[model samples]
Target: MLDALRIEIVEVSNEKVVARCPFMMQPDNTLDSFMGSFNSETVASVGSWNLLDMENEYAIGLEISANHIRGESEGTVKATGFPIHKTTMVWEIQITDENDKPICFSRCTTAVNKRIKKNNS
Candidate 1:
């Protein structure tokens, strides 16, 4: 589903994760303007999930707050996620345009736990 949106991982490490996606106005937009909030949130969530890298675990978003600062209608937008206050489940996300200009800022909090195993008969 994400691939369909053209979101891709740009970088990943123990410290942070970066992901990018092409920006375009949603087809349902009547104003023909770029709606960046949804894409920004998606990248932020995905970045945090990748950074966690909890094997056999699940991470569900508890909260996500995004501030859309600037709009970019062309090229790709990238989001970088960093841990906040050294906490494993809280992240600060920054979204930038292709030229590395700030587009959005976000904070995400997620609940992490082991994935429940399914019983097989």
Candidate 2:
């Protein structure tokens, strides 16, 4: 899905993750501006699992809140995610345009779950 949207993971680490989406490749709204869903997707793509050291466990988004502060019609937009509360699996994301101007802000909460193995019975 990220490929379809042309979203690329530029960086990743235990403390932060960054992604980029270029306007030329993104789907636009009626006004030919960036879609808020792009911000949501960018925010969600960071996934809380990436920040955790636990193996065999993955995180699924429980809630997401995005604020589309401004619109951009051209250039690449960057989304950066950082842990808000590691234990609770909360994160904050900030999206900015090529000029480094604020485009969106978001917060996400996820639930960590053990990856269940399937029994081929």
Per-residue lDDT of model 2, residues 44-118, tens digit only: 546575665456677777787777766667788788888878766787888888787887788877777787778
* Candidate 2 local Cα displacement, residue 50, angstroms: 1.8
Model 1, range 1-121, lDDT digits (tens) per residue? Answer: 5678777877776577778787664454221123344454555566556655466766777777777766566777777877764344777878787788987787777777677778898
lDDT of 1 at 77: 76
Model 2: lowest-lDDT 10 consecutive positions = 25-34
Instruction: Name the best candidate (by TM-score).
Output: 2
Q: What lDDT score goes with residue 9 in model 2?
A: 86
C-alpha local distance difference test of each model: 0.66, 0.69
Top-lDDT candidate index: 2
